[model samples]
Target: MKRKFLLLTTFCMMVLAACAPGGGSDSEESNAVSGDGGSGKQVLDFWYIDPGEKEKVYQEAVERFEEKHPDVEVKMLRVANDAYKQKLAVSMSGGNAPDIFNSWGGGWLKQFVDQGQVLDVTESIEKERFNELALDNTTFHDKIYGLPLGLSLDLVFYNKEIFEEYGLTPPETYTEWVEIIETLKENNIIPIALANQTKWPGAYYLMNFAARIGGPDLFNEAFLREGRGFDDPAYVEAGEYIQEMVEMDAFNPGFNGVPYDEGQGRQLLYSGQAAMMDITMSLVNNVRTEAPEFEEKMDFFVFPTVEGGQGSNKAVGASTGPVWSVAADTENPDLATELIQELTSQETAEAYTNRTGSLTAVSGVEPEDEFVNRMYQVAEEATHLQMPYDQTLPPELAELHKDTTQALFGLSITPEEAAEQMEAKAKEVLE
Candidate 1:
C-alpha cells in the first residue's frame, strides 16, 4: 500500500513540474502570454505604400517610436502603391488587417469607415494642428478617421530651359496655354508628357478642365446628386478640350502606352523631348533624385483659368497624402495612436518636407527650397481644391471615371458619352 501511494505521488509531482513556466520553450512561453508573442514586447503591424526615400522616413519614425516606448515593437511593412488597396482589402476580409495602415483619404478610406473597419480618431487627433484642406479629405460624416500627414497638389511642371529656348513663359489663361502648346508643337517638341496607359494621369486633364470650366459648384452638384450630375455641359466641354489638345498633337507619341508610375513621362521631360507635365508635387523629389542636374531647369505653374469659365484659377486638383489610420480592431489601440503621433510629429514632418520638397500636413511646415516654396504657396492660397475623382468617388464609380477618361484620351469615346457613363455609375452606386 505504501509503495503504491509513493508511486502515484511521484507521478503527480512530475506532471506538475512539466507544466511549470520554465518547462516550456521560449516560443511556447510567448504563446502562453497575453500579447507579448514571446518577445516580451507588444508588437504592432504597420503598413504603408511609400517605397523609396519616403519609406526611409517612416522607418526612422518607427525607430524613434520604439525608442520612446521600449516595451513596444513596430514591424513596418511597405506595400507597393499599385497593390496596396487590393492587399488591404484581402487582409481586412480575412480578419487580418494590420494594426495601422496608410491610406488615401476620401472615398478610398470611406469604404473602410462604412464597414466599421477603421477606428474613429476624432477625439485623439487635434484638428487645429493640421491644415484644414488636408483634414478635409480624411473627414467623413463629420468625424475624423485618419491622421493627415501631407498634401498633394497637381501643377504644370515645365522645363525652364526648354521654355526659354522657345521664348515661352507660363500662361495666365487657358487660351494662352493652348497657344503655348501650339508653339511647342510647331517647334517639334512634345507639348505635354502624359502616361495614360495607367489611366489616372489623363484623368487629371479632364478633372482640371471641368473644374476650370464649371467651378466647384458643378462637381459638388454632380457628386451630391443635387443638380445636373456629371453629364452637365461643363464635363462635356472638358472632354472637348482634351480632344482639341489631342488634335494638336500636344502629347507624346504613344503617350497612351506609357505608364506614369514607371517614370516614363518624367523621362520625356528630362531628355527635353517634352516641355511640360501636369503632375503631383512629388515631381520635385523625382527630379531631384532621377536627374539631379535637371532640378535647376524645373519650374511649375497652376492650371490657368479658362475664358468665360466659372472656376477660378485658384482652384486646384489636390488630395491628401497617405493618411495613417488605426484599425478598429487593433489590440494595442493606445500604442498605435501614440505611434501615429510620433510618425506625424513636427520633426518627422519637417524632415520629410526638407528631404523631398513636398508639403506636409503639419501646420507651418513648408519646403525650404525657393522654387518648391512657390508651388507650396499655390496650394496654400488655393480658393478651392478638388480632390481627384478616383479618390473622391466610390471605388466602382472611380474606376469607371478613370476608364472613361482614358477612353476620351484615346478618342474612342465622346465626352458626352463618358459623362453619361459616369452619371449612370454614380447613380447606381450612390443612390
Candidate 2:
C-alpha cells in the first residue's frame, strides 16, 4: 500500500513540473511574436503645406491609419506655403528629406525627378481611377513620380449683394465684362479687387487673360520650346487689357501695396465693398468661415471669353496645390509606395476635397458647397484647362511677367513698353 501511494505521488509531481515549464514557454513565445510583429513600428516622416482648420481631419486620419497599421508610426510636418520649396530643397540636399512630401505638378515635379529626389509611384498607385489631367500632370520623361490630391480650377467669385445692388449678372464675354465694370463704377462700387503687391495673385489675371487671348497651346509651346520668347501679340493684348482696367479704376485704392491674404480685396468682397474677385475654389471655405452670414451671397462663374481667340471659351488657370511623392532613397520603398497609394485613394481624395471645399483628382465626387460645385461643373464643361502661366514659364520669365504687369498697374510703363520688356526678359532667359 505504501509503495502504491508513493508511485501515485511521483506521477503527480512529474505532470506538474512538465506543465509549468510548458506554460512559461507559451507566454515567452507570445511576447516574442508581439514584440517582433509584422514590419514592426516603422516611423514615417511626412511633410505638407498649411492644413488650417483641416488639420484636425488629417490628425484623425493619421490615428485611423496607425490603428490599421499597428506597425507604422506617422509624423506630420506642416510648412508655410511660401517657404516650403526652399525648405524641401535644403532638406533633400542635406540628406534629411522626409520619407514623404508634397510638390507642385509639371515643372516642379520634373525638377525633382530629374534630380532623382522623389520615388516613382506610377504603378504603385491606381492611375486608372484618377482624373486624366491630374495623372498627366505628375508624369515626366515617361515615368510617373507623384499622385495629385486635388484639382485647382480658377473661377471668378462675385458678391451677390454687391452685384444685385448694381444689377449685374455674371458677364459672358470680355465686352460684357467691360460693360459690367463700367456699370459698377457708375454705381460707386469697385469693379475688381486686385492686390498686386504680392505679384502672383495679380499674375493670375494677366496669365489667364493671355491664355484667353493667345490660345492654350501657344504659351506652352513658346515657353517649353528652346529659343522661344513671350513676344507674341497675344501677350501684349493681355497686358493692355489689364492696363485699361487699371486706368478705369477697376481695382480698389492702394491695391499695389496690399498683400494677397490680408489685403482689402478679400475683405472688400466679404463686406460687399467689391463686386468681383478672381480666386481659387479653395477660397470658398475660407469666405464661409470668415463671413458665415455672407455664405449664401457668394457665387462663382468662369472668366469672360475673348472674341477671336483660340482659348476664348476655355478655363485658363489652376491653383498651386500639393502633389504627394515618396523619397527615392527610402529604406522601405515598397512601404512608401503603399502609403502614397493610400493617400491618393478615392476615399482620401474625397475627404481632402470635402474638407477644403476644393476639387479632387478623383472623378465623380461632387462638391458639397454650392459655389465649389458650380466651379467644378464649369471646369468639367470647359474645352481645355491651361496650366497657370507662372508655373509653365521659366522662373525668370515669370518674374518678368509679374513685374511688367505691376508696372502697367502703376502707370510706370505703357502697355507697349510692358510687352517690349517681357520680350527682352524672355530673350535673356532663352539665350
Candidate 3:
C-alpha cells in the first residue's frame, strides 16, 4: 500500500511540474490562459487613428471580431490625427509597432515597406472585387501591403443660397470658375474661405491645379523620380493658377493669418462670410453639427476642367483615407491579416459609412446623404485619383510643398519661383 501511494503521488507531482512555466507541457507554454485550461490564442495589438466617431464605430467592430474570433484577441489603440504620424514613426523605428496599425499610405507607409516592417499581403486574401483606385494607395509595386478603409474626396462646398445670390452655378470649366471668382470679388464677397496659416488648405488648390494641368502623369513623374520631376511646365502652370487666384483676391481677407482648426475657417463658410470653401468629405457632419441650418444650404462640386491642359477634371482630388497594415514582425500574422480584412470588409465598410458619413471604399456600400452620394459619384467616375503632394511626399518634402504653396497664395513668391522651390524640394525627396 505504501509503494502504490508513493507511485501515485510521484505521478501527480510530475503532471503539476509539466504544467508550470518552462517545465510545463510545451503546449501549455505556447498557449495563453483563458479559463481553467489554456487557449492557443494570440493577441494582436491593433492601432488606429480616431476620426471622431470612429472610436465608437470601431468598438462595435472589435466586439464583433472578438465574438467571431474567440481564440484571437484584438487590442485596440486610438491616436489623434496630428499626433498619429509622429507616434507611428516612433513605434515603427523602435521595433515595437503594433501588430496592425493605421497608415495614410503613399510616402508615409512606403517608409515601413522599405524597412521590411510591413507584411506583403498579396496572397493572404481576396481583394479583387474592391475599387481598384482605392487599392492603388496601399499597393506597393504589385503586392498589396495594406487594406484601404474608405474614400476621402476633396470638393468645393458652397452655400446654395450664396451661389443663387451671385447668379452663378457651380462652374463646369476652369474659365467659368475664374469668372465666378472675379464676380464674387466684384460683389465684395470673399470668394473662398481659406486658412493658409495651416498650409494644408493651400495644398488642396495646388493638388487640384497640378492634376488639372499635368494629369496624374506629372505628379507620378515627380513622385517616382521619373523624367522632368516637379520642374515640369505643368507645375509652373499650376503655380500660375495659384497666383492668379491670389491676384483675384479669391480667399478671405487676412486669410493668411486665420487658423484652420480654431473654427475661424469653417465659420467663414457657415456664417456666409465666404461663398464657397474647398473641403473634405468629412466636413459634411461638421456643418451638420456646428451649423445645422447651413447644412441644408450646403452643396458641392468637383474640380472643373482646365481649357488647355492634358488633365482629366473627372479625376478627384482625394485619398484612400487611411489603411490598416500588418507588421511584418508580428507573431500573429494570421490573426492580424484577418483582423485587417474584417475591418475593411463589406459589412464593416457599410457600418462605418453609416455611422460616420464618410464614403467608404467598398463598392456597394452607399451613404444615405445625397451630398455624400454625389461625392461618391465623383470618386467612382474618377479617371485617376490624385494624392495630394503634402500627403504623398516625405515629411520634409511635404512641408516644403505646403510652404511653397502658402508662399504662392500670400504672393510672397512668384509662380515661377514657387515651382522652382517645389522642384528643388522634389529632387531631394524623389531621389
Ranking by lDDT: 1, 3, 2
Candidate 3, overall lDDT?
A: 0.79
* Reference-based TM-score, model 2: 0.83
User: 349-396 in candidate 1: lDDT tens per residue?
Assistant: 988888877788889888897977887888878888888889888999
Residues 365-408, candidate 3, lDDT per residue (tens digit)?
Answer: 87776767777777777788877776678878888888888888
TM-score of each: 0.90, 0.83, 0.83
Displacement of residue 89 (Cα, Å) in model 3 is 1.2
Q: Is candidate 1 or candidate 2 better by TM-score?
A: 1
Task: Please name the candidate that would achieve the greatest lDDT relative to the true structure.
Answer: 1
Question: Cα lDDT of all candidates, in order?
Answer: 0.87, 0.74, 0.79
Of 1 and 2, the candidate ranking higher by lDDT: 1
lDDT of 2 by residue, 1-431 (tens): 99999999999999988898788567656644543355677777788874564455456656767787887878799887657778988888765678888876776666677789888876666667777887788888767888777788777888887778777889888889999989988988888887668776777777778888877776766676543347678877887888778888888988889876654668888777887888766566566466768768888778887888667655547743567788886666776677776666667767777777778777778878676677677777776777765655555677677788888778788777887887777767756
By summed lDDT, which 10 consecutive residues of candidate 2 come out lowest?
Answer: 30-39
Count clashing residue pairs in model 1: 1
**What alpha-carbon RMSD in Å does predicted model 1 have with respect to the real structure?**
7.8
- Quality of model 2 by C-alpha lDDT: 0.74
